[model samples]
Target: MSPEQRLASLLAMHGENELVEFKEAKNQYAFDKLGKYFSALSNEANLCGQSRAWLVLGVKDDRTVVGTQFRTKTADLMSLKKEIADKVTHRLTFIAIHEVAHPQGRVLLFEIPAAPQGLPIAWDGHYFGRDGESLGALNIEEIERIRLQNRADDWSAVTLPEASLEDLDPEAIEQARKSFARKNPRLIAELEAWDTPTFLNKAKLTINGKITRTAILLLGLPEAAHWLNPSSATISWILKDRDGLERDYQHFSCPLLLSVDEVFHKIRNLKYRYLVEGTLFPEEVEQYDPYIIREALNNAIAHQDYTLGGKISLVEFEDDRLCFSNEGGFIPGSIESVIHADAPETRYRNRFLADAMVNLNMIDTIGSGIRKMFQIQRNRFFPLPEYRLNERRVQVTIIGRVLDQAYARKLAACPELSLDDIMLLDRVQKQQPITDQQARHLKKRGLIEGRKPNYYISAELAEQSGDKAEYIRYRAFDDQHYKQMIIECLEKFKTARRSDIDRLLLDKLPDVLDANQKHHKVKNLMQSLKNQGLIENDGRIWRLSNP
Candidate 1:
């Protein structure tokens, strides 16, 4: 193991309260705490002159090491790392996780690196400091000191002084007014009495009758878009085949609110059909929900990182998934926070621009856009919208229809499943790790089987899919299982030949394996099993090495 990993393992073995510190996993842990811990550990590592710090999981207070069996697979752990990097300052990441096998059980060792010089991490706009053994809020002076280290202006709110009313597109403005009326029917009378300038002001498009960059972005004429220096004020919609090769591309000019419909018109929303649950009759649904498309487009216009000089992009794939990505990261901590909570804590990258969008009815003010997207996907039996955040951008993917009917039907049969449950199941289908809670739900429904590191379609889901044996064979060889199988084969056969093992186990392998590639798989399995200390292999044969 590396030094950082060794340090973390040593800390965990000693006990959290005795070596490291312990704090309640509340809001910061509950909401923003991960970011805080990342920053605090990063800074503390610098102060102590240590290469790394430890964030040991499954421990309690008073130096007591109450081992936590809160098992998270490798992929789940990586997801956590990605989430923290996406939200934290400067995209700092954990060095490594060392899983130490202590006498008590397994202890997870999180190796956090020191903060970079002149840069401190901020979690959801707040900074934290370690006070003795407890974590307390950072003081104003320290916070200010950290803030001064990074100086970047908000680009979306910048005023376009040279642009005038003549630069605004009349057609786009008229369409914006109509959309506003549609969103708020009660404001129709008041809206009709107002003139163009008054409407623009009421819509929050313009500030005190002066044209802003937001206004030009949403409704600027082609020439006006050209006048906005540095970045092009256009939204590009691209349709790609399965290979990610662009088949078609189109650009739309501002005001984006009015042009959103025009952009939608460019997409081919054909009808998709699937069989009914009890009957063979096909049920047809719209390829994509109109409201979801509008919400996605509006969100892109509202939250875009215009300062980065990147255009908003909408990419459609042959798999019936639409990916909407902008040049900004999610201001809220996560997609889960947006869906679970009824009202989100007000936070925005482009405050003025977002407010303008709210007034124009382009986006919802109550922060229900994401929740609504989830609800729509659920109602349609389609995959829930997937949100991915990288260093400087957020991507939202909305799948149009159920690609796998067997999986969809199995999911639909379990009506008691929560959004979280469905999300976990989706992850499972995507070969991602399901949380402990999700694993329990799936087991309770008899839809999934296996313990940690061993999971597959349960007998119930397999029966529903009309292929019990096939499903079992596919999910039979989890990492641990495969390793164990190799050991068992060697013990039984004394000195098992590679071909002999392949003949015995290849038939029971998962569907992901091709019939033609069975020999290659056997070779790979032997290598993996040998590496895990479960078996030993010479050039020609293999035998059991460890119990």
Candidate 2:
């Protein structure tokens, strides 16, 4: 069938749905907005399990062909594909753009490929998806559904009969032997007595005495990567400076078991020393914890969706943070569940690979790794590990040092607080919003005080911890302070404009209030003074009543 007829048939059958977007670009359309639509429609197609999405230009919202004059030149239209690929995540672009001249008007049909499984398409680092007919941020629940789709299938479990023990790297195998022996000290002699293949089988890297994709990815020679075909077995370590500029980068391919240590060694984990209030000597600790780094890298390896052909990424910033990302969402839904649950993830994207790592002493599968990361940060009085998960990927960020010494000292002073409470307080210190339920709990415990969108640390606790000035900075000031400031300003200037009053009082107002709130506060104080015959504003300027 002709492309026009096929599109017409699709429109008649499907109308406008999640996978089909009709835009009446009558004269023209912005290129950037077009990119966003591509991201939205492509991700929608993935969620709907469709092969492709259609961006039908010259079509009205009601399915009428309005005829668009968008990018008349053929070359200009064709160049859009490359333009979009340049800015989008992973270089995903349109599959085809068909210009069909209909009887009434010309229709421009752009076919967008469905988002790859376990990897949502993003435009300029922002993910977009359809919410019925409205386009916005992909719903978290829908994101989770797309992420959970691969939980039942294990990419690492697929056996490759063509692959032989010869494909494995000898050095990697030796390293794996020592790691496995260390993990199972009681069977050290027995494990050392076995041959390489026997040891690989025991380590769960082999399937039914045969090498699998997991084995190739973890221990195979770099040249043996062809056995995995389209999928890559590369870990990219990137070092970025404080200004977000790339300082250096190194890619580790195959022999991932040994590459973990190599990547760790490349990072400049310098010693961080901080002086205690009472201690004579400063305490020294490594900026990045060794266990934290290995666990993060191992988690990335275990959860990466190899079918997507994306490489694991480890990004380090000179400002003291490490970010590890893998191309699959967190399996257990939320980080809170992982931090609080007694059990490991119920399902894994790469179960066989995770099992092998667990056996090889790379990571623990009992769910203690993530919680331990949080606890270790807490013990050091540093910010907890952050897990940023969406449909496309999971990124874990480990902060190395204290961001705010006052906040850290406050947390250290309060040892009775639970980890959950500490996490919420950390959010407050970072100025991140929390849910109303969390606010209520914090208020009930005297941990926080004030109204919505303007909460501050409890005044009593702030005073006790020597943070009273910070508390006053964030909390609303008493009415007397506002009145006095205005009276003093008007008295000094003899006549003051509202803007002048704003300049005098705005900064003195609570840090929690936005500009509009501060304006209202000043206006109300002036009105109250006027009512008592102390001050009055004539059109633009205010003056003392007696003056």
Candidate 3:
């Protein structure tokens, strides 16, 4: 219905409902308060299984239209959509702000869309909902109920009405055929007899000879990208210098079947050379395993949320590391589950895209994809893949070279340690914190020791690896050791400055503590000695206790 007809229909209602809110903003409305109502109504719409909610300005809570002069100009009023989008979750805003000239006066009807599936809408980090016409915080149960609506409808499984075989690139289709034949080698001779449309159907890239978004993304010509409209199929490859400056960049649009190779070749996979502790000759290997680059890129393409209209990004930093980022939170939730699970994850952000890629030999959901990435890096003595997952994006960084050449070979020596166990130990070595539960699990294996945020490889593992000295650097010393040293230094030096005390014990502190933390540690230690009447201080200087 037209905006005028819809407004009249809503006006005839007995009172305001969960999907509609009426406001008499005679002169102005608070932007923040407006945002809260937007969040509340949007969330309520999702919960009620409705597509949209309305916020009618110039209309009172009693359904009386008194007219509003809020942003009377058209451009000024429409800009509110962007204003709301900037602060709301996922940048989702109004479908349209409808203006209606009613018999009462001029009314502004603000259209708000429903929250995206599985993700709740929040205004300034707070969720709001309606309690029988009263606005309040969305309760935990309601919030979870909204969040649990995870992608109920699969966008990738949809077929585009305007797309056909003519839109597909010839070269990309040929590559797809080669990949599919290779994946199903038993059908090689039979595949030669199949036609283009017939082959695409068999490969699951189309439905009943109709092109799917997956087909357009993987094999469709560049011009066919328009069929996906608001969602583009683009992969961006960027190269950066050691200083994190972008030196070169390229954006590859459909057909992505061939662009994957182009993007891979653009990455400078130089040879990484490192020497083992006991060896004179430097061991050499390719900076990135070929499978790693392909798997990571394909995984990004397979899991990317195309509805966001963002490009999959692969950044190569001076040939040392490759960081691949896609626009979507991880479907499997955590990298831990993917690494530790014996089976593959059936959940995917783009199920149809991932399945087609598997048929095209671009990706595999089996353990060979993610789990093998870790094992390959482990076998090469490199750090395990790093996953940075959050609400809107998933980024994975692959370190191309060994961090500690000495400990790397030794880490390999821990054959009894599972890949998952070593993965957590790798975090400890990098000074990354593990949960208390994780620490306890590792401690039970005698593979780690010390406290949270300062855990170190255990003494037994250190002895086995013959890196006891390195272990001591990570291990923190007792406070008594530091206190006695300070007392002894004061006795010999008469009056030592704060710097002198720092010099005495700063290097003796745990390597994990940064400069500021080490200074804080010294401050605490000096305060402890003073409280015990073990030392006398003259402001900047300290002397031995005077009884």
Candidate 4:
């Protein structure tokens, strides 16, 4: 069938839905907005189990072929693919751009390939998906569904026949032996008795002494990295000034077993001092916990998608934050899920790499590493680790210094609170979103106030945190207090304009409200006084009922 015929059939049968989007670029359409539609439509196609989705230009919402003048030139239209490819993850471009000459005018059908299984397509580092006709940020559930589509493939297990012991760094192999010995303390004598090949085989770095990608990634010589083809075991450490300019940089290749330390040492990690607050004395500790540093670096290596040919990045900021990023989407779907998972993740992108790392005492398979990072930060009264995940990469930011000392002190004092509770309250302090289930849990504990996604620490938390003044601002005055103010104003003036009542209560309303919300709230308060017969309004002026 002709392309236009197929589009007509789809419109007649399916109309506008998750898999089909119609746009009337009568004159033109936004480039950025079009990119967002690409991400959303592609993700929706994956969820719907379709091979492709349609972005039909020159069509209005009424299914009329109104025609689009957008990028009518053949070359101009062709350049859009490269423009989009530059910004999107994986450089996913259109499968085909068909310009159909309809009876009305020129109609373009851009065939968008469905997001690849296990990788949701991202536009400009953000995931988008459709909810029927609406386009918005892809929800967590949908993102996870797309990511878990194919979980069985393990790329690190692929064996490289040409690689040998000579290609492996001798020092890294010895370091691995020591790490293995530490992990298997009971097998020290036996471990020493085993030859290097035996140790490599037993350590799962190779498949029956056949060097696998995991071996080359962890213990291979720096030059041996080329054996992995496009993939490289390269870790880049960048030191950035407060203004975000690169001040110093270094890259470590292969023997990731030893390079992890080199990257760690490059970080400033200066001694951080918790300032005196209330009765608590100042205490000093390393800005970054040693465990956090190793766990983050090791996790990045273990979870990195070496197939992407991208170097693992460790960006150290002078502003007391460090960001570690690797080429791969977070497999657990969300960091919160990992931090709260009751059981370990059942799948890994690099199962062989993970198993080998476990044998080398590099990481645990139980998935408690991420959770422990959070606890360590909470115990130190620092902001919890922040994770930024997208289809292209998993980035984690660790803050070294205290952002809210009173809040930290209050949390430190609360020995009865569980780690989960402290984490939620920490989210509130950070102004991050919490799940509805989490919101209810915190509300049940009376630890937060206000609405979903906008919750503030409750008076209990604020009062205990030594910030009652701020809490009062968020808590606002009682309705009766505002009502009495209205009554006093009316009695004084015999009558008052709605603006006067608004002026009295707008500033006094909870700071949680936006300007529009504050104004709406004042209107509601005046309405209540009128309903209570304490005052009346002539749709313009309000006065005491008796007056």
Highest lDDT, which number?
A: 3
User: Worst 10-residue stretch by lDDT in candidate 1?
Assistant: 22-31
| Candidate 3 per-residue lDDT over residues 373-464, each given as its tens digit | 88898888898899999979999999999876535856756766767578888898677877654666678778888876777788888888
Name the regions of candidate 1 deviating beyond 4 angstroms: 1-64, 68-131, 134-153, 434-446, 450-454, 463-508, 512-547
Candidate 2 Cα misplacement greater than 4 A, ranges: 1-152, 277-280, 497-503, 513-541
Backbone clashes, each candidate: 12, 0, 1, 0
**Model 4, 1-547: lDDT tens per residue?**
5676877786685468998899989889999998999999989998998878999989988789888899876557756767887787766767657777788988888888788778898999999999889999999999999888767668899998878889999999999999999999999999989999999999999998899999999999998988888886889999999999999999999889999989888989899877545656778999999999999999999989988988898999999998999999886556644554434555678889999999999998676898999889988889999888998899999999998665686776566887767877878788777765467667777788888656877888776667788787778667789888888888788988888877777888877677988888888887787788888767797778887
Show model 3 residue runs off by greater than 4 Å: 1-152, 276-280, 365-367, 405-407
lDDT at position 532, candidate 1: 71
Ranking 1 against 4 by TM-score, winner = 1
> Counting only residues 3 or more apart in sequence or on different chains, how many pairs clash (N, Cα, C under 3 Å) in candidate 3?
1
Instruction: List TM-score per model, in order.
Output: 0.69, 0.69, 0.70, 0.63
Q: Cα deviation in Å at residue 337, candidate 2?
A: 1.3
The TM-score measured for candidate 2 stands at 0.69
| TM-score (C-alpha, index-matched) for candidate 3 | 0.70
